[model samples]
Target: MARVQHAKDVAAERLLSIPGVHTVGIGYKRRGGEVTADLAVIVFVDTKLPRADVPPDRMVPLEIRFFMDSSDREESVPTDVVEQARPVEYTHIPAGTLAGRARPVAGGRSIARAASGGGTLGGWVWDGLNDEVVLLTNNHVLGGAAGTDVFQPWGSTAATDHIADVVRTGTLDATIAAPVNAADVLEEIEGVGPAVFEITTATVGMPVEKSGAKTDHTTGWVEYVGLTGHYGSTNDFQVAPDPGMPNGRFAYYGDSGSLIVERTNPSGGSWKRVVGLLWGGNPELGNAKAHQVQDVFADLNLDTLCAGAFEEFLDNLFAPNFPEEPLKVTPIQLPEPVTMPLTTGPRVSLSGALLALQQAAGRPFARSRPLHRGMARDVEARLRLSRMGSDLVTAIHENRVGLARLVLDRQTRRALASAAAPFVEGVWTADELLGRQVTEEDLARFHRVARIAEDHRPELQPLLERVNRILGELPGRSFDDVLR
Candidate 1:
């Protein structure tokens, strides 16, 4: 009886048992996780419950109480998390460690209320300077907070953080906080403050913790701190802090502004420092990113509790809040996760890096007579990749970061594999996809990448510096090492 069943099949039978029940309901669905034999029960019900309380689009949380020969069991139903929280702005935000704890207007969302731990959503803050603190969040999510004040978007643009204001205007004390306007919205919104960050002297791999409304408080370790991307850009990381903790379930909605506190054990004693303010993860990955709070406070030197006077002042610079229409900044679908384990081998697995490198190579070994149609499609698959490799060499020699970024995009990465196939073709069987080769022309193209590792290619550097022990073995190898 645990197997899921058609609501219609059991609906009539259930209604027949209830004399006063005049209507029967039916539905079909596979429960979360799996369809186990123990749970394969058909859902049919005869209810006098108020169905009108919720709209057709709304889902009701039903607590099913059922028992077998031994004992009855109960399961709490779930509602779409989005419907519970509406969009909000910094104006409605408050300062605290707990996420989603703020009193969102009748219908809105708060970071204090996001999921907890690594999987939680919402913006957060960190005490930045001598007195003031800074707020953080994404630009796309700003529109939602400004418009509806509801946390409706779960998969996409749902959570946000804004600069907190302490002042009050009318009874509508939007003093808790207000939203910042990055050039995206200037004319329409009222006091608009763009999200900003302050820098700190915190080192990488520090242990940190933050509070959220949903889960209260959680802690994690830093994977990277003050990191610069391809173009010398700074970024923050908060991955699985410790080995014991499970993924997600750490923080929930409305946890934004939670502090990332790390402790340092000095020779004299141990102390804690404020590092950053929560910023939404990158759009493609949705991984959490934060603004260096230390720098933010120092930049503005604004007061935090001055009834939000600083926030009020900053807001005034932005366009008033006359949302002509709903802002276009909405969360889109998330990208697929990278689940493969880290593996290393000799030949640069250009295909893995390119994502579709094999497709690009299109090198096809000759086969016996065609046994089926569409055999023409089996021509040469590896060649396609070889051509791709040649193209990459040319593009790299030309020095085009834009082209490289394009090739790296998840969808079209195959083109890069197609370009990189040749350079890696005759590579040593024991070689792994360490990184792209450096060239002589590349010296003028991107010198930074070239400097990190000594030139293994003879043509690029005639003489290898043997002063450093790390460079000892480099010069002994053939110059062609860079090319292969």
Candidate 2:
């Protein structure tokens, strides 16, 4: 992986200088419209051309060979030429009223400098050295030196709309702003819930999602990591929109400073781990570029402030109201079972199990059927269970004894166990049930129970481990040949 990255670094500037090349990075090679396992230096161009029509010097090379000082040998790396238009910074003037202002401003909302156009307010972070929570966004969006005023929802002039003042600026087009009232800022995004305190490095083919000012919430896959672009940042990464999406778009104008996060499914809900900061992209072609979030943190000396396990537990416990009175209701009646004639049929196979597991893990919020009646009640139940499950996992992972003790209280445990009974039992019998394919909702339910058991119930650890092993064997989870 280091060799490939080094080779890309060596070749990026020269490639960018070429007339047709727009960006340079490392990615999987494509052959006859199919992605291959081979690693290649990817060159983005406006259009693919036949060798006959282009000048020899302007054409992209098929392979890049460079001498390695560490190995004392010349290495040859293949190249992949992809057709993609040049990406531009995502900042623009507001044409109409934008709807993204709140008392406590969060990430993924429109914000701009007093004199500049609008851009997204990435998220909130803690400046430990300064002992204050501040807003994280692009330097271009919150331009000028320290003390520049920023407003939310585009061209607002009200004094109340003036939210933050630029505090620090750094490389990767990142900047931090001190909120006028620290209490008026939140550590969450608009559509996505609380941001996870942890941050991770981007890997090729990793599934990612982001909420931006222009596009709202969208999911995508990392096309390349350690990408070198015209922006002069060596840690930039490229993302392409999910093929299943309707418009095939990810970020757009006014979407700068949006936070790109990993799409992960834990017990409580879909938690987002900060991965990168969206700065610019070619929205029409669905090619977006972002800086590695770790770089942003290191450069700015900032840390994320997210909700802890005990806080989440308390919020889940008291936020909702249960029915005040027990109403008389008819019990469900079961029909008499009848033996059926046996016929030749396909038995459950490993492939089927893997498919079910992938669907469950990949799309955490997918539902099998739409609910008409009692929808709100059902949603509340799921959310409560999810929160409790997440709290247990977080406590275990962080080794928070106090939080764990609170989460494992007798009353809380009983409520959680009762709510998770159906899902926990289904995990055991899921393989036994034949004929029908497992639905994402069913697997999501089982996943929640498995997470809770993995953290609290030792007896179920073996089952959970076996399930994880199967998940590890699933294909298409990663696509970086360099990592192999």
**Model 1 Cα lDDT, one tens digit per residue, 1-484:** 1311222233334423533332222112234533222322122222223556544433233423333335455332211111011112122233223223333211112332133121122231222121122233333323223222223222223435321322111111011223222111111001111111112444444565544333344566554343322112233333233444334433333434333444332321112344655533322221233445554444334322221222222222221222224337876676875567898778643323442432232211101111122211121222124453344333332322122223223233333333334333433221222233434433232233233223222332322232122223233342224232
Model 1: which ten-residue window has the lowest total lDDT? 183-192
Worst 10 residues of 2 by lDDT: 363-372
Clashes of 2: 1
TM-score between candidate 2 and the true structure: 0.62
Local error of candidate 2 at 235, Å?
1.9
- Candidate topping lDDT: 2
lDDT of 1: 0.30
lDDT per residue for candidate 2 within 99-186, as digits (tens), equals 4677777788888876678689888766533434577888878874887778887778678888777777876689888776544665
Best by TM-score: 2
